[model samples]
Target: MTLTTSGPSSSSAPVAEEDGRRVRRRRHSRYLLAPFVFTVGTAVLFGLFFLWPGVLGLSYSLTDFRGWGDLEFVGLANYLELFQDSEFYQSLGRTFVYAVFSVPVGYVLALAMAVALTSKGARGKTPARIIFFMPWLVSPIIAGVIWRWMFGESFGFVNYIIQLLGGEAVPWASNADLSLFVAVLASAWGGAAFNMLLFIAAISNVPQSYYEAAELDGANGWERFWYITLPSIAPTSVLVILLSSLGSMKEFAMIQALNGGGPGTQNRLVVQYIYETGFERSLVGYAAAASMVLLVILMVIAIIQLRISKRNNAW
Candidate 1:
């Protein structure tokens, strides 16, 4: 015991422990270094690209900056004028109508395709899926062009068939309503494939036992789909509707290519209006104001949908 005198100094034990802790801290820092660097880099890029542009757009909306010199701040004049603009209101109304029609049409088509593709009695699923999904792969502009040709009043395949059948040719180009209808159908046809893919994934994840149990209970095909399949895929349905609504509201390229917002601007949508105002008319600040309003509308829709989804989930 007395000979334990110099085994080691108490201070030496504490020094060694401190050194060990320093080594562990260094090791921990090394482990975190890569992730920290990547996160910082991503944040910087996001701020530079997205956040900065958004802030700049907001600033432009408050000023009379016509994409030119001397940004004179006009307070809320742009917004006030936007509220009183009849053209803006008309464009917004058309956008709302398009969204209302297109979203449901696309949703129904996609759901039907998904159910058919996923059914046990289905045949040649691979080929059918490929054909259905081809529209989604095509550019919206090209899709519009293709549809325009098909529905063209003069040489269109549809009109040709109608003529052969001794029926009047539809005025898809000259009549605003018919043009808008064609645009709606085109949008649904082009967008359905993408939503179908989403529904397919959701349907696949549904528990097979529920369907089997429903069958055992003598549930018919329609009953099984209405009760079991639809309820199980509610979340996906909500997602598809939200996406379709947003896309329809912001539709520009397809409609522009198809009808040029034509038949005397009767089919022009909000986005097309904004584009014409900002670039075509050189009313950058005004267009920015309109864009901000559209942004608010989109935000409101998203918030409402998310709230509804949350409530449904809670129930």
Candidate 2:
């Protein structure tokens, strides 16, 4: 008697097809793995650092939480008090003044320096660029200290020059009004170099052919610059303006080092006031409220800048 095997044969073709399917699934998983890791990593970082801190800060601002005590929910009391405080308003005004003066002056000087440096007829351009940029390399606080000495009423370089010209010594960091001016000047000095570099790159990208055509049409240097150079670098100008404005708005280190926000809070910027309130006086809730206000102001300014950029097609 002949007996036949009942089990089905394991063919190579069927096994190969199963293996190919497994391999394809693994390849598809690998394709998605990198992006998945990146997405999760970015979310974790943002939540840990930025989002969580911001949420905590906003929460604290709504409470009367002293640095180490139990938090008491006040429900906008801190904000109401902040609006009524005269010192806060004064500091805000001072910050505005600083931004208004420093931003434009810095931009203008930087544009001029960039134009000169990018000129084909220029000599010692590299050295000049280095010298201009050197101030920016130094920390803002350190620059403030050095300039404070320079502006010293007695035995200072600036005063010495004034005396040489039969001029009286001027108190730069002492008087409130003059202190603000000195801060603005020091800030502008370092800021100009940064804007200069940006302007140089922007100016360089403008097609030389445009200038050539303008020249052929009997356009003078000034005309070509007005009609071509300015328009070409308009986007860069906006960027520089935004950066400088933000820097001026948040100016703290320079004001601190220059005069320690002293001479009776005359030179105090809003940030300095916030620091004094939070750390020195231990008014954590009030200071947090002030910081939140500043944050809102900054956000508004950023939104305005973005809108302007979009309108101008700068971005």
Candidate 3:
């Protein structure tokens, strides 16, 4: 075998043709220098946290993994078994329901709160924003645990209020239907502030010219909002919807703590289901399949949102 290698050649002319050696060189230089450092940094972080876990999950998905001895190669058996599981389907259905409730509701509430606080020269805006965002800063696990206490059957502050009002205290986290309702409510409460702050910043950055022109046209508050405010913050809305949908579908901590996924698994979020299947049940391969199923669902919804929102953005 013979190896021929060229070291950095100081005598060569730099290439410059568009779509040729030169353009490629230019693109390579411009996009591939400091960006290479960033790419490496990103790769390291992603590999450590995300990509490595994903690769492991994928490999596990192809085997009859029980986390001991040799993992038997089972191809798609885990997936097929997951699909056949009634609990898996119910958990998935519940996840979709959670997404339907949480994503849009969170976006609307956040947008409204953001609009309110971001009103030009609005007083107390900073304080209100801080208060709204406080929930987001708290750990999700802690929030779930706290909410569980607040919504618990007998001692819950919520039911206490209902009882004081001469209404019967409803079991917020104990009933099948009520647990899902409470989970949605808790998710919205905990999540809104974070998206609200994003919206506030996005709206604030909108050029004042849009609002000024709307006002000069004798537009009322609603009219100004419809034309100026909505368009100005449309991209932020897209971002919030995309992120919240993904988060909602995989929600676990709150739902798990709130009612342990049910009065009978009626409130089982998909992540909890995956956790139960993998760790609790020692079906790691099955859990991996569930994770892939979630990824596909999220990708489908994300693609739809991006296309629809991008088209709407053009209008």
Candidate 4:
């Protein structure tokens, strides 16, 4: 705390040192203050968009409010009505079925493709990503429309190609079994590129030391994955699965364009049923309630995913 002074027989050197220390302390406090302010602001902004809607949805699900006045009190009535709605039950069943089919398929395909693309540091990485990722870049509505042509019953590309090979033209989006299957297939086709980008980016960062060590130890391909690659990218795999399931649940454009939830609701999903209820029949409250249920299911899955991943600490 040494400080020289020029004043004759007088020096406020110690005072100056104390004052300088105080100034430094104040500057440090100012630095700390900024992050505190920013954090609070960020929290509020997020609450407004993400948390606020969920709160409103929850409130509406329990009441008769539909973004309208009065907010009439009706406890759990909307949920009860959902139970009695046959179409809702059917749609929900189909939504889960779709999730079951698309979740593993989309994520696995993405991982495999990403691994291969990055394996040799493929020179085609850019084009491959651009090509595969193109589907995700396309507007959902546009993709749905294009896919509809490709799978159209009579003159669609799939049928036309089959005819070219002396095969039967199957209605990809018409038959019940085929509709759901094709919808799941379409999801995998459209969604793989998105997951691939994420997976590839994640796996690319994995340390090569692990692989080199495994190879040096004479580990087989399966053993290396069991001990190395899977461990390296497990977190990404979990994230992809979660996102794929969420997307499948909320899917609309493709389903709407493909068969309009037909063959008579055979492939109708819960989200479509919500659309029909809210905009089609003006049951806004019911639609909101149904959406809340879907949100709950997603939240539960997210919680489970996070918990399992954290517990495993596999990445």
The global C-alpha lDDT for each of the candidates, from Candidate 1 onward, is 0.94, 0.89, 0.85, 0.83
Give the poorly placed runs of model 3, Cα more than 4 Å off: 1-34
Better-scoring candidate (TM-score), 1 or 3: 1
Error of 4 at 71 (Å): 4.7
For candidate 4, the 10 contiguous residues with the lowest summed lDDT are: 60-69
Residue-level lDDT for 235 in candidate 3: 85
- Residues 296-315, candidate 3, lDDT per residue (tens digit)? 88899999999999799777
TM-score of each model, paired residue for residue: 0.89, 0.86, 0.86, 0.84
Model 3: how far is 57 from its true place, Å?
A: 1.0
RMSD from true fold, candidate 4: 4.2
* Model 2 agreement with the true structure over 1-315: per-residue lDDT tens digits: 999765445566788899999999999999899899999999999999999988888999999988997999999999999999999998899889878888888889899999999998999998999999998898988998988888877867999999999999997756888877777788888779989999999999999999999999999999999999998998898889888888888888888888887678876899999999999999888999999999899889988997888888844
Write down the TM-score for model 1.
0.89
Winner of 1 and 2 under lDDT: 1
What's the CA error at residue 175 for candidate 3, in Å? 2.4
- Supply every candidate's count of residue pairs whose N, Cα or C atoms clash at under 3 angstroms: 0, 0, 2, 0
State candidate 2's TM-score. 0.86
Clashing pairs in 2: none
Clashing pairs in 3: 15-22, 16-22
